[model samples]
Target: MAAFTTGEAVALDLPIARVPTRATAFILDLVVQIGLALVLGLIATLMIALMGADSAWIDVAVTTVIVGTLVGYPVVCETLMRGRTVGKLVLGLRVVRTDGGPIDFRHALTRGLTGAIVDFWMLGGFGAIAVITSMCSPNARRVGDVLAGTVVIYGQKQLPAPALAVPPPWLANWVVQLDLSGIPEDLALAMRQYETRFRTLTPAAQVGLGQSLVITVCTRLGVAPPGNFPAMQIIGAVIAERQRRALTPPYSNPELLGLTPAALAAVRG
Candidate 1:
């Protein structure tokens, strides 16, 4: 799996295209480009024959066709298709930046120029340099991809959603009654982190951290910690209570909502 980490520190698991698949795509693209060149050359020849064009014009047209077929084709396709050429689309592959963002025109241009100069055309037109580079690189990136800051990946896979901790059934009513708004942002963040990863911790570590967090939260809320309640339950309840309060509308009179003045004042204060 190729993990693309964003600036936000979120890691995404995406499949990287292997050498065999990439080579196949490249072969297909090469065949298409060759066909395009043949057609363009034929058209240019016919135009020259009909117009009685000079030798200089013929040389210029041949150079243009060769350069355009080798370099301009990939650049145009990648830019218009947003990193997807015909071959890439056929193989369910896409070129993207290391951060998993879409590649831009400059990236496409660099890749195309580098690929033509060193990877394919320069190395006996056998793509020997590209193959060796991809084999040697950790992520199977060729010289073009390295120079362009891009990578090829299987673009169709979806990332799974993270499972969040929920409040325990026994503490549901108790949590709704408490003034959760008094909890500090840092403490709340700690509770959330603990709740999310408590199951992964060892028994001793879980107990130690959960107890510390429960004590801290209870102190911040100006309430006595319940000894019988599970630590995970307490943490989940606090998280749920905060979310609930955020979604709940404020009442005009606390007494009407069965909340004491002190309870309401705790949140306001």
Candidate 2:
């Protein structure tokens, strides 16, 4: 179920799975929808009879349409109920980004809208073709995803840190721009591993992990790291920048290591 990068053998490194087929998986999706809609319809009918109410069948008719079902059902269910739709639950499925991140309300709405279109005209007409497109894609993105700048991935969610070896003392000194001479060995070792772990990840993954590292380091060191440079590079340059900052006439403010003064000011401010 998992693959690796040929170069690094790093995990979470492969392109994510292709989104499930719109035709096949979505066929199941529609069947679940119909069964659900009928169940709701039966309930509505019973409620109406119990109240002896018939003010507007138009509301009933409108709700019955594919559009209403797609948007209304999941919106109410997931928004109010934490990502579980009646249809999705029955199918043993949940919607999420390919990376297994939570889909925001906007994205949930997009999925519903696309599903409605797919349902209305031969189960999404052109959109259904995107399902086939997804299979060919290494990352499993469908037409809706392609258009919307998203992807669909499967399996249990993963947090985004790559396991890493300890970093060199030089690198840690560069990132913190502190002598670190007085810090105890064990504490320094722990900090070095933390920074190295983020560095080992791909650029996109690094940012997510690095932001936490940046905040923690800045709070401890009294300055932010330079934002302009890649986190790895900044860590590498930290010691040199600190040495320069220390020599300034007035003993300059402890700006972030590895960033230009202007860049450091921008990020800190």
Candidate 3:
């Protein structure tokens, strides 16, 4: 259960979703990065050659470049290599503070090198640690995230709608038909409960809750839950309440359209 680090690596209340970047894709991201690095290295070499320093000074310059690469190479590599850097991109991830913040160079470098102890040495040992810890911790942090203060998220660039599954058969039927008037009031209540359980929680937590709700909601609603369904569907059913409740009088509580996220969070508190 990780918190969302909106832009920087601060503690987040929400967890960014994970897109599995397994061995094959990870290798691909690496190959792409290495290719980029080679181009950069060549440019560095060319600049040095064009300078045309004296033979003695040339040696010093080259030596300086080598040392600079030692410190700077990883920094460059980490950022360019993995969408964000080595440790993050490798795991199909990126770094952010628990407070919903973007990670800076210092944090990225620290996490990249320090996390190497796990990610590099045992070859996937660090990857394994990151995956497991993300599952175990409240903020879904990896070793580097814990030490450097960051969060590993999947899509740093896009903010997708949060989705949940439709547990009850009627709910599922309502989703596809776009007709909610026929649904019973009981199922509506079920949908509301279903939304609360999955939507507010982190993806890591939702993973399990999602599985359970699929079964429970189906049994009660006299329908089979979809195996491996998206979370958005559940939200859709709840959202369908707008259409379902349209039949009711407009004597209306503007709040009846649905629960605002703030209200939901308040209730969660």
Candidate 4:
């Protein structure tokens, strides 16, 4: 199990995919790649025979078949499938950012390139390097994962998401005024985790962790932490406001939505 802190400061324990499972997935994918190569190769052969193609055309066809199956396959699958190649999909595994976010095309491309060039094919001794690297790494990450800032995990078994933070009525105006752009996704995740799990912690932990998070968040926003309010409330307000901004359409006015200063004052009173 590997622990990842969310933007809300919650620690999430996720099961890492070890070599055994990864190897099985790789074998499954390899079989598919080989099958695809054979089919394409046969098609190329038929085309050559029927069309009386020259040596140059044959060379082009052969190169296309090899590159398409070996490199293009995983890149396309992972990018389109959101990090699950055929083998990973079958095994309920997925590749995700180290921060537990979904990977984009850039991440998939890097991993695919690195896997073909270093981890499995050209310099890997047919996966010996990958196996050795995974064994030595705490999270079972191979060279591709390290280069791409990703990890493989049992996606089907992740913990249920925590309840979302609701913005505090009294702080709605204040939260809306603060700059939240500087806060990173991981930090935001940590704050959300802290908000949801606030009640679960002991009194001491509540004070310690909440205060620490408040300081970190305030620093990120280049603002001062509110001294009068409880730390949990501040964290919740920040998270809720962030969420509201994300969901609300651009050009929407908070005051028009009944988030007026008068309403905030009434809630505070």
TM-score of each prediction: 0.58, 0.45, 0.36, 0.68
Best by lDDT: 4
Residue 22 accuracy (lDDT) in model 1: 92
lDDT of 2 by residue, 47-133 (tens): 777877776864764466545556676566655543456544554444554433345567667756665565234465645556566
- RMSD in Å for candidate 2, one decimal? 14.2
**Taking the tens digit of each residue's C-alpha lDDT, what string does model 1 give over 1-269?**
77875322236888899799999999889888989999999999999999899999999889989988999899999988878888988999988877665677999999999998988886626798898999998888999999998999986753222222367888887777888767865576577677766778999989999998888888888888765888888888877666545434662433212222344455445
Q: How close to the true structure is residue 171 of candidate 3, measured as C-alpha lDDT?
A: 56
For model 4, what is the error of residue 212's alpha carbon versus the real structure, in angstroms, after optimal superposition?
9.9
Best by TM-score: 4
| Model 4: per-residue Cα lDDT at residue 146 | 96
Of the pair 2 and 4, which is ahead by lDDT? Answer: 4
Predictions in order: lDDT: 0.77, 0.49, 0.50, 0.81
Which parts of model 4 have CA positions greater than 4 angstroms off? Answer: 40-63, 174-182, 190-235, 245-269
Per-residue alpha-carbon lDDT of model 3 for 78-115, expressed as tens digits? 45543254545555565555543345576667765655
Stretches of model 3 off by over 4 angstroms after superposition: 1-13, 16-19, 22-28, 44-94, 116-118, 121-140, 155-269
Clashes of each: 0, 8, 30, 13
Model 2, runs deviating above 4 Å: 1-11, 14-24, 50-55, 64-68, 73-95, 98-100, 118-123, 132-138, 160-269
